[model samples]
Target: MHLLVTGFEPFGNDQFNASGEAVRLVPDKADGHRITKAILPVSFQRSGEVLAALLQDHQPDALICVGEAGGRDEISLEVQGANVDDARIPDNDGAQPVKQSIVRGGEDYRPATLDPEIILKALHQAGHGAYLSEDAGRFVCNRIAYLAYGQKVPALFIHVPALRPEGQKATVGAETDNREAALKAQPRTSCTLPELAEALTVVLASLADQMK
Candidate 1:
């Protein structure tokens, strides 16, 4: 099976976005299925356009989009996307969408393809904490997660965190800028970039096995 994976460019409040690092490291670290990768601009306004282009360009058998869901501490497999858009924070373009569907009036939402039960089980067996997220959140993560299912291909959106680079804190900060605030407050995630890439490999390999 062919897998198209996406990770976002670092955006607001985050200096250590691991998604990009994870996706970039995939090809070198591990593989069973073909992994095509793309780095998404950190703008909600551009997400659909980029995703559409990717669908047209690669047309992979399965799509796994990874996004930084800052506050989450575990591997979260999103279950469903809310049709309505309500951004608690503005996107990279400074646009805040609220009370409107991701698609103004196109179609309803669909769930993820990687079995929540199966994938979560595997992650735990591999000694990585995991869970099923009720909300993908009303951000670009949700936007692409929603779009993936409508494409008639197996699709999933995995939310990762802003892991502290050296697994240590600055230990000296009086004021918290957006950067500092994100570092301490969101706590990114605990997993390393290399670990995430390995997990994606496991996911794709399992998916292919299930298909066979």
Candidate 2:
């Protein structure tokens, strides 16, 4: 099976996104499945465009979109993607849509094709902190998932917790001092990049087994 796994770039006050870093660490292959990984922008409009292009180029059997969810201690296997774009803060391109429909005349909710319960069980057996989450939020992460659902492919969104401070390199810019400080000040549950990568590999393997 071929899998197209995606992660997001840094947004808001975050210096680094755990999802982007973790996807970089994920192996090229898992359980006889070919994996193509890409990092997406944190923009509502651009993220969807990029994801659409990737889907066209790769045309994978399954799609897995990963994003960083701060304050969440466990890896989240999202079950549904609401067709809403209510951003608490502006995205990377400074576009914040409030109560906007992702696709006009689309369904209010799109259920994920991947079974979160089965993936949750696999993660537990592998000793990873994971849970089934119904909400994917109304940010860019949810927007990508909502767009992906229209592609007629099996799609799932996984939310990874923040990365440990040591897991990401400090940004080298005097201008980003305040943003860096703010990121450090936020109280968040974090995990190592390796840990997230391992959990994602397990997820891919499990998904491949399910397809068989």
Candidate 3:
């Protein structure tokens, strides 16, 4: 089986997105199935087009799209995508769509064809923080997830926090206290890019087993 995995580029104030970094680390093969990687733009207009083209080119048996979710400590296996685009900020291409439907005539929501429970369990067993999330948010992540599902693809989205560098607390979505002398005293809840890569490997293994 050929599997398609994708991640978004750096958007917002982030210098690097863990999703894209992790996707880049995924091996070329997982559980004897070929894996194809796509580094997608954070633009609403171009993301769909890029994903559609990859789908056409690869005809992957399953699709997994990954993105950064600030403030989330765990890897989120998003279960559903709403037909809405309510961006809190403009995308990479300066597109800030408000209350827009992802697909003009698509369903109000699209449930991921992949089994979220199984994926969540795999991540847990692999010692990665993970959970089943109902909302992929009304952002680019949701748009791609809903699009893939609507097109009858076994697809889902995974959200990861910004990777924690060597000696700094991941401040992606944290409040810093001026009173604290040591930044390390602030809780560090985010994982590294390598951890995210391992998490995806676990997910792919589970998917391969399920597809069989």
Clashing pairs in 3: none
Best by lDDT: 2
Per-candidate Cα lDDT values, in order, are 0.70, 0.80, 0.79
Deviation of model 2 at 175, angstroms: 24
**Taking the candidates one at a time, how many backbone clashes does each contain?**
1, 0, 0
TM-score of 1: 0.84
Which candidate do you rate higher for lDDT, 2 or 3? 2
lDDT of 1 by residue, 39-135 (tens): 8876667987898899899888878888766656677788876565556566679887766787777666677765667777777777777788877
TM-score of each: 0.84, 0.89, 0.88
lDDT tens digits, residues 36-116, model 3? 999999889999999999999989999899987665677888788889887766788989888888878879988889998
Query: Which order, best to worst by TM-score?
Result: 2, 3, 1
- Model 1 scores what on Cα lDDT? 0.70
RMSD of each: 5.0, 5.2, 5.5
Q: Write the per-residue lDDT of candidate 2 for residues 1-212, one digit (tens) a residue.
A: 89999998887766788889899999999977899999999898889989989999999999999987765668988888888887766888999888899999899998888788888999999999898877777778888877876678888899887664654533311111123343453435656789999999999999998788
Candidate 2: clashing residue pairs, number:
0
Model 2 residue 168 lDDT? 50
Candidate 3: list runs displaced more than 4 Å. Answer: 164-188
